[model samples]
Target: MPGDGPRRGDAFEHDIQVGALRPAFEAAGLELVEIDWRAPLDDFEGLSLVLLGTAWDYQDHPREFVTRLEELGERGIIVCNPPPVVRWNAEKRYLRELERRGVAIVPTVWLDDAGHGDVAAAMNQFGTDRVVVKRQVGAGGLRQHSFSRDAMPDQDWRMGRPCMVQPFLPSVVEEGEYTFLFIDGEFSHGVLKRAAQGEYRIQSLYGGYETDFTPSAEDLAGAKAVVAALPFDDLLYCRIDMARLHSGELAVMEAEAIEPYLYPEQGPGLGERLAKAIVARL
Candidate 1:
């Protein structure tokens, strides 16, 4: 597993995902080593498998990250979630692909060399005055920002960098983000994460917190449909993030097929379940 960001206290300090998996993996007669994806390594030879852990820094060097994963794959070391899947999902543009597949997604507009009029166009397209801007290939809320259509600045970021513009979903701050975890394509657990007061980002790094959530039948059905709409089967792990719309419908915010944080602590026996999933695949 790959780890990055501020490391203080114990090595597994705030890493519940790794902390939970370690014991279960060892119990299954396997050794687990957590490695930072950004660290220099000659090769991935000698490894049974490489799980893409919280490689939060990958957005800074996506090509290098994919190259490393490819190296591991060519060396016969299985990369969970698979390298091809990572390549496809690493970019936010996959949301557009999902929309094309009939999965409900937040209305979005892809932009490159955007001008002042493009902002208004996005607002008009989504029928909303506020919009969220995000990089095409980013994670952990890298460079994600919200701006009023009329208040957006003429910045150089919109010139060459690729980004997507979407109407700001107020439900994120009102209802919260719902996440469903699937191990080996089987549902494992679901959690609700709320942003900090007056904030929109729901990651803990942004002071958000997780809590228990009971999804409606519609929620489950909608999420299931989205999962089935994906092109692959037999994924090692996946996290589907949904938002409750004003009309009480669930819209996919993201289908994390890569290094999504699986909050094992939120569900009983989830770590063991994940371990079983991995062992079964091996």
Candidate 2:
């Protein structure tokens, strides 16, 4: 992991999130504190809630992360999205479940270990020349690959971990990804994340950028439907990421229930909204 750009996904994003939420949390008589998720469980004592904020490295220590959250929840601490939800969301295969539950998502082929041969097969299966392969437990576009039939990896090249393969969607590059943030099961705001030129991943770490967006009624309804499809009914927060499919419907790219960046810049009222929701829960 040497030369990895930053310890977290985006330093500026973390700063903005804290800046926006801290004053609002204070206004509601709450104090905001940042803690390492690996800290002693007793360190979480006396906290009314843990937002799972900025645990960006959790993908590398997935079980530990979820176990820690589970322990916190067992101690009666409020863990936003909760441990169970985090566990379910940790694996990308949950998309299959969402699809089964009537949520439209990018068509994906799950693989335990994907090599060049598998990539070829996936492209054949999806009937597309270009495809994307992503770790089942990844974040911030880390360890993701985009391949075209003409530019396949060598035969021995393998993604030595569980992953999902999907046909490369032109909409990702043409229209960018859409993020809908929800607070207490209600839509809070929308952000359009555009990848850098020549890139397909719409994460800030990859030079992607965000802009405030107001979706049309049909698209907003599509995002809300994804939220409604989540198995848990008591979620405190969710970020539903979607992309416009060729069919003109917004299909889910991700249903981020764990530690998603809420575009505070796009949603200036995010702080107050979060504070109100947190206070109501207490």
Candidate 3:
């Protein structure tokens, strides 16, 4: 698994992934090694597969990251989900592709940069008083902002980066966001991520917590649709995160095929499923 070695910022999540996946890979007769992604690519010469793991800092050096993956692929190393998939998923704009494929997504207004004027315009477009502005290429809720009509930003305030604006979904705090982990095009498990009080981001780093969740048939179908809409069919793993729309239907928040943490704590079989899928790819 390609990782950031020991100094990775998200140690807790890294441990969870390694603890669960290492043994499973062993039992499946595969030798799993964790290596720093930034380590010389030559270090991976004898490795057969490069499963993108907790290289969470790749967002800061996206170009370098993609080049590394491409180099690995050129060396005949099997890059699960492949380089093209990674390239497409590195930016959040891929959400637009899913929406174009007829999948429901949280209404979004794509912008080169977001200022107070853009925020107000978005609120009017969505008919919502509150809106969220998020970086076009970000994860873990970093650099995201929430503003209500009454709490508009100053004229000079700006996101100053490519961004997307969406109406704040009340169901995020009222119910919670749901994540469905799909292994090799099949549903493996579900998790409901609930943010702590006064927070709206459902990332564990922000004091969010997860619980085992069994999706309703309709909701599960909705998540399945997201997986189906993906352009590639050979993805070894996919994470579909959804939130309820005001109409009581689930809408796509993210179709993560990158290095998403497959909540093994919530789905005990995640390790085994991933290992088996890896083997199948070989």
Q: Higher-TM-score candidate among 1 and 3?
A: 3
Q: Report the Cα lDDT for candidate 2.
A: 0.90
Q: Write the per-residue lDDT of candidate 2 for residues 1-282, one digit (tens) a residue.
A: 212454554767778888889999999899998887877888889999998677788899999889899899889999997889999999988899999999999999999999999999999998899999999999889989999988998988989999999999999889899999999898999999999998898888888999889999999999999988888998888999999878999999999999988898899888888999899888
RMSD of 1: 2.5
Quote the positional error of residue 49 for candidate 3 in Å. 0.3
Candidate 3 ranges beyond 4 A from true positions: 1-9
Which of candidates 1 and 3 is the stronger one according to lDDT? 3
Residue 82 CA error for candidate 3 (Å)?
0.7
Kindly provide the TM-score of model 3 when superposed on the true structure, using C-alpha atoms. Answer: 0.96
Regions of model 1 farther than 4 Å from truth: 1-14, 40-43, 155-159
lDDT of 3 by residue, 1-282 (tens): 234245534468878988999989999999998887888988998998999887787777788988999999999999977889988998889999999999999999999999999999999999999999999888888779999989998999989889999999999998999999999999999999999999999887788889999999999999999999999998999899999998999999998888898889999998899999998888
Number of clashing residue pairs in every model?
0, 0, 0
lDDT of 1 by residue, 1-282 (tens): 334455633224237877788888899988887667766654455887888887766777888889888888887888888888888888878888888899998777888646556777888887888988888887777577787856885754353478888788899999899998888877788899999997899987677888987677778888887788777885888899998766778899889998888877677677788788777767
Candidate 2: deviation at residue 244, Å? Answer: 1.3
Candidate 1 weakest ten by summed lDDT = 5-14
> Model 1 — TM-score against the truth?
0.91
Q: lDDT score of model 3? A: 0.90
